[model samples]
Target: MARIERVDWLMVDLAPKVPRSDAIQSFVSQETPIVRIIDSDGAVGTGYSYTIGTGGPSVMALIERTLAPLLLGREAEDLEALWRDVLFVTHATTVGAITAIAMAAIDTALWDLRCRRAGLPLHRLAGGAQASLPLYTTEGGWLHLEQAALVDDALAARAAGFAGAKIKVGRPLRQDVVRIGAVRAAVGDAFEIFTDANQAFHVDEAIRRARAYQELDIGWLEEPLPADDIDGHARLAAMTTIPVAVGESIYSPAHFREYLQRRACSVVQVDVGRIGGITPWLKVAHMAECFNVAVCPHFLMELHIALCAAVPNARWIEYIPQLDAITTQGMRIEAGRAYPSEAPGLGIAWDWAAIDRLAIGAGQVTLGSSGGKR
Candidate 1:
């Protein structure tokens, strides 16, 4: 068995193509914490996690100070065992954003290494349940866009072969209705229209808005209330025919279990980074499947494409190309479905030169009898 010989991490700040705003916050920049793990056989695998505008440095610090060291010299193939070790060691901070994000960077790298060693692409390695999945665009649906722009953007997404479009909610209910109505009018009832409030409503407000949204035949209403409010979600789900989607704000399988058990969320929007990588991500997906829930994962469609393709219950992939600027290869969309790459591992051909030019800081650790550094 090949042993993990070294672990390294870097922080890359990726600026958005345009400012993206939602109900709760605006994404000024994406602070991405990236990790590369090397095995004794000279194989390397890459993984990453991201934050909206801040806290990336904390993720990096956690990796450098704790997680990376814990991974030194371990058997690279023991992904689940290593994942548990890290979680146990960082138990005090477990079930939080930074901790999950940190674990994600390491766990994903391990999975990548496992896939590469086996010489299979991640979709195949994970399960290969599907070759492609339907796509929906969120890039054009930011809350800041004018109604006309939003309608035009939705039309453009449709013309580009997207099956659905997501428009932000949480405006004055009348305004939200008008915007959703305008998009519906533009695209007609054939194309799916989804809405995300980004956790900007109370239970009663969500009920009222969801009731209004049903008249428009909205495919789903996402994150109407805070993600932690299981009762609120359950109440809102019972109140409307619109499927309630959540998961990006959630950090663990246990949280997902609670949400699923309560019948709160109809669609699982599992973000791999927030769920601590593909290891627990699969657990969450299978859990959703068991509950008869469909998964429409949140952003990072670049890597998420393979994960989505691997699971049977994966319904749709939210198309937000945050890594487009720094990656040589990207997801391919055809007739509204995203096709997974055939390349081994996660299949991301990162532009390392571009990444290095933008990197803020980096650290490395090597393993040996005394945990050598090189």
Candidate 2:
């Protein structure tokens, strides 16, 4: 059994390829908090979570002050038990973002250790249902892009051989309809198109917009309503045929169960980062499968790709590259799909030198086996 030896993490600023905004929030730069869990042996495992330009320090402190210490000298191989321990300790703060983000860093690191010890990649270790999953691009689909720009971006994704492309929609119904129409005209009827409103709609307005999108043959309407409004989503789903996809902001598997039981959403976009990492993520995916719903996860494609490949219900992986600058390698994409690396770990090659260059000086903490600050 591998005993816990130390835990380390760094806060780094990772900017997107462009300045993108959605209905509710503007993503200035992704504030990334990563964790490195070292066992008694010389081996190490890494995991991370991010916020869209906020809360990096709080997540880091939560790990250092609360989560990391509980891990000291524990069996690193029992990932599920450790995951439960941290979640139970942080129960007061959880079912929320900061605590969940902190839980994700450690939980994922433990899974990395499990996979490494078993001599298998995460996809294989988890389930290995598929070797590759279809891709859908969300890079150029911010809510602020103009009609012309949106059309050009959709066309670009189609030309590059993507299975689908998503555009943000929160404008007035007429304007949003026209924008989607323009994109459809450019990319033709065969190419798939999806829309995300970033939880910007209420029940009445969401119903109206879903009606407008039905004729467009849109793939799915993602986050059309606030994630917490399960009854409203159920009403909207009942009112329209446009598939309602929600899950990015969802914080726990219990919340996902509420949506699934109510038949509130048709597509389950379980995000590994937000739902407290792979353990709960797999739970939600399997939960969705029991309901015959598709699992197309949100951002963090690098990590999600492996989880997506592990489950039978995972249909698509959203293409949003965030680690290109800080990592030595990138996602393996071809033929409009993503392939997870077969290497015996999480698969991305992190460049420690580059992360050090971008890491923030404040709140950078590491702990030894004693679980005290060094």
Candidate 3:
């Protein structure tokens, strides 16, 4: 009989000692504001939405002023109803960050509530077989790192007990090849190595680079071309012996359906936040299974560990290890795998004191702006 009684949005910012970048931009600092939901019974669940430095306040506002108002007295059990309610009310604004980020916060909190109610881990509730999931180090391939830095990182990943490592690779053709070759030589083929272009290349260029690195026994090529270029990905998948991976930026199951039907990529990388919530994520997992495609989800990887363990074809979950500063009971990674916690709910909790300390300005967020936020 516990109903959702209140929702709290808290923002946290972490400063990286160095800058991180992709094909688009570099991040010197990042922010993740966690959304906490309390039920009438006083049980609390936590969720998070991805954001950059400037947008955290806006996301917090949308959730507080817009989304929270609708669920003040609603039954917590009607999770999907509430999810759809937010979607319908925010329909006109569905194309970008504000809505999806808000949806991520609430949807994740609801799943946390479900897990707590069942007295089970999210992995178990999803029918996962193992309590631990294998992880691979990511953020290794940025062009900014020197060759020595790249090799050192790869070697470190091996030392960390990771079975695999992934790096970014959209630089000039020769530079990327040298980095990939160095990583491969350093890891010595026993370790799985993957690369992401961050949608930085033309199809022909991607195919050429992928073919070049294929000799190093690369495990997969991720987001070689733009996510919308399904035909291009399908072509790359067909031509290269290397497996082509896509998704991440895709917004819905319908988008995934097209990618699958077109035989776009061998590996599917779904984002828990962008593709709606846990429910839609489950559907996408099953759909990937039906098509015999491997899933190695995008970041915010701690949550995906349970989903990967539940789905048979999930190859590996990406690990950044940077989010631990904001989470309570940080997930323990043993030998490149994440070990699940006995804690009820998502096995994670928010550092409220840390969160409260990071708040920027207020009323920059309005309470109940649209029909609701997302």
Candidate 4:
């Protein structure tokens, strides 16, 4: 059995090549908290979670002070038990972003270790339901772009073999409708167009916009209402034929279960980082499947491709390139679909030199038998 030997973490600030804007927030930079765990057998696993900008230091502190100590000498393969132990110790802070984000980094690293030890890719080790999954592009659909650029981008994405593209809505109702119409006209009737409000609208506004978007043969309406507004989402979903997609803002499986039971959403947009990691991520996906709901997970496409391929109900993987500069390789997209890598574990080859150069000074932590400091 491999015994945990040490844990180290760093916060890296990643700026988008171009600024990404949605309804509620303009993403200036990503605050990524990365964790590495080493076991007695000399195996290493790395995992990470992200925030829009703030909270990286807080997440790192929790990992270094509370979570990492709990993992000190445990068996590396007991992912579930270790996950529970972390949660139980941090139970006071459970059901919130800090707790979940910290748990995600640890849980994901464990899964990565497990897959490497088993000598299999994560998809096959998880279930291997399909080899490749369809792709959709959101990179070209930022809310700040002009109509001309939006249309041009949609056309380009279609030519690139992507099956669908998501456009950001929540501008004035009329403007949102016109933009969707412009994209639809450019990509034509055969292409699928989805819209996301990023939780920018209230129930009535969301319903009004969803009604207008229906004429465009839109694929799904994502996060139109605040994530906690389950009643509003159910009301809106009942009023419109367009499927409601959520999960990026959700923190736990219990929230997804409530949304499913109440019929608040049609598409499950589980984010591995947001949902605590691959362990709970799989649970949420299977739970969605039991309710006959389709899963179309949010970002981190490089890591998500494996999870999507492992589950049968998984529908689409959002294309957002966040790790391009720090990684030697990333997800490969071809003819509108993404395929998981055959390489063992998460299949990402980190460019350690680049990561060290880009690492932020404020959020680094190292823990060993002497404990540590963040």
In terms of TM-score, which candidate is strongest?
A: 1
Q: What is the C-alpha lDDT of each candidate?
A: 0.91, 0.88, 0.76, 0.88
- RMSD to the true structure for each prediction, in A, is 1.4, 1.5, 3.2, 1.5
Better of 3 and 4 by lDDT: 4
- Model 2 — TM-score against the truth? 0.97
lDDT of each residue in 1-374, candidate 1, tens digit only: 79988898898998898779999899999999989999999999999989998899899889988999898879999988999999999999988999999999999999988989899999999999998998999989999999999989889989988999999998899999999999999999899999999999989999999989999999999999998899999999888889999999999899999999998989999999999999999999999999999989999898899999999999998988888878997788888899888888998889999988888768788885443223
Worst 10 residues of 1 by lDDT: 365-374
Clashes by residue pair, model 1:
none
lDDT of 2 by residue, 159-266 (tens): 888978998988888988998988988999898899999999888889888998899899999999888899999999889888999999999899999999999999
TM, every model: 0.98, 0.97, 0.91, 0.97
lDDT string, candidate 4, 1-374, tens digits: 78888887887899986779999899988888888888888888888889888788888888877888788788999998998898899889878888888899889888888888889999999999988998888998999999998899889888989888999987888998899999998889889899999999889888888888898899999999999999999999899999999999999899999999999899999999888999999999999999999999999998999999999999998988989889998787778899999988887878899998887633322334465544
Best by lDDT: 1
Error of 2 at 152 (Å): 1.3
- How many angstroms is residue 101 displaced in model 1 relative to the true structure, after the best TM-score fit? 0.6
> Cα miss at 19, model 3 (Å)?
2.8
List model 3 lDDT by residue over 12-87, tens digit each: 7787534677776676666665776778888777777676555777777777777777777788778879888988
Compared to the true structure, candidate 4 yields what TM-score?
Answer: 0.97
